[model samples]
Target: MSLGFAYAAGFVLATSTGMLTLLGSGEFPPWLWLALFAPSATAVMRARNRQAPGWLGTLIGGGALIYGTLVVQSQGASGVLIGSTSGLLGIFIARLVTRTTLKHDLQALMLSLLIVIAGAGMNSGVSYGISFVAYAVSVVWALVTRQLVEGAEREASLPFGATLEVTLARRDIVTPVFFAASAMVSLVVLLSTSFLFVLFPRVGLGSFKMAQNSGLPDSVSLRGSPMAGGSGAVVARVKGVSGTQIDRGLYLRAATYDRMTRDAFVRDSELVGLQRSEWARLAHHEDARQYDVFLQPVTDGHLLVLG
Candidate 1:
């Protein structure tokens, strides 16, 4: 159950962040970095000599640095720069705090700041701006609740379930507190997951929608005549035409669109009913063209054209 819970938590965290990125955030999607959790599982081993690999920590630190640099460069100097810089600096400060005399007291504060600020910086956007903070809080709350559960379990295991009589140390109390706190964290995760899913757009998987450009007014197809002194890509050539026969605007269809929505043009279904005869007539006309047609490699699906 513990392993299942951990894996589910990790997956949920990753998947939620990934969805948010698609919704137009600049943050490094958590789903892409969930592999970072592998090192965390080392705590479960519990063997006397078992320890997390130093390389794991180094990799995370290095990865964060590289990620910060990329975010700074891609977003321009002032876009996400302040947030990214703050996050990286926070991580450094957290590491220093962990190494000092006030380490125990400052650990949670540093860790919380590192996750909340860094995560927010990594994936900034209007809709998902607070996601990182929620995620950080959830994690901390879960840890606290888990600790509380462990202490409660230990006390309950005593003879006659003597937890009622047992006095808990501050450390012991903390674990149960964490366990209860996990309930609230779970709720937050559930809410965040729903928020992302409901708002994230569902775009066609293969088609890319280029941003609008008003400047490029003229367009030409591959079947259009070659430019002066330029060898154009041959999509088709007319044959069996007499010397005087001239071609006008020849129609070429590269893809078909059938379904139209308020915002999208979707692939038309080939399902036949009353439309069979109408479609057949069009197909017959297309087949009669004496054009030696060439087609570029395309998605492996049936292509249809309508005049």
Candidate 2:
């Protein structure tokens, strides 16, 4: 049961991490704070060998569905998504309170995964990455414990008229060796995943963010110092196309300057949008060097090109 509880803790960790991510992304409703109590309450009941009544679950589910319907008029399309997830939230909580059944556990796990995937698409920050890593670790831990628990249940299957009683300190099951083994196994899983991530890189895991800017200023000012260019951070990486060889030194144009000053080069305040027809009319030279430029995300969405 201690091992089972440990697995439950992992389940809670993964679910909570996912919910927090969704909340941060503004995809999840703020009512998540109250919804969290269901898992916490279920965990407590699981530890005490108690099951919440069936009617209570029905009431919770029904109430959630009703509330979701009521908010649809005010919230619009997002309200519909919120309402559906909230309804499922009740079902998820209901499953958590039930006895150790794979159906119940699997359903809850999948639901948590749904939230996690949604969260992954919504945010691209260090905190979200940390949460995802923690979620991954907890998922691994939960899966291991879940398998062990199922085997234990099968072995200790109770027949009619037979009551099983278990009384043992946590230290008996959760020994130092158990923890050491868990840590090593977790480390191995993390390292393996990290290695694969580095090798294949990003392979369509999440949605593409529309934000294409970095933390640089939109307009340049030569008011301060004579120095040009930005802090030594990389702006873009260039690679030659076909069999073409890149020159050792080349001037990469970012923005064109209309006027030059003793202090700094001044860029035109009024900029015109380049139309498709205008781009097509430009002269095309066969001898012009061609290279692929991979630019990093920046706050200033400016095009950096090599001539």
TM-score of 2: 0.54
Which 10-residue window of candidate 2 scores lowest in summed lDDT?
161-170
Q: What lDDT does the true structure give each of the candidates? A: 0.42, 0.61
lDDT of 2 by residue, 1-307 (tens): 4766676787787677766665565555576667666667776776687887777777777887787677676798767866766666666665666635655777777877776776666666676778777777776667676676665566557563212224122336655576567667867887887666656534431223345332346455433332224666676676754322333234444553444555665665544243233223322346886666776533142344544
Q: Give the clashing residue pairs of candidate 1, or none.
A: 27-122, 27-123, 144-178, 145-178, 145-179, 146-178, 146-179, 147-175, 148-175, 148-176
Expressed as tens digits, the lDDT of each residue in 167-260 for candidate 1 is 3223444344544566567677767775666465342211222553423333322222223224454434545433332222334343544344
Candidate 1 TM-score over all chains jointly: 0.31
* Pairs in steric clash, model 2: 213-298, 213-299, 214-298, 214-299, 215-299
On TM-score, the leading prediction is 2
Backbone clash numbers for all candidates listed: 10, 5
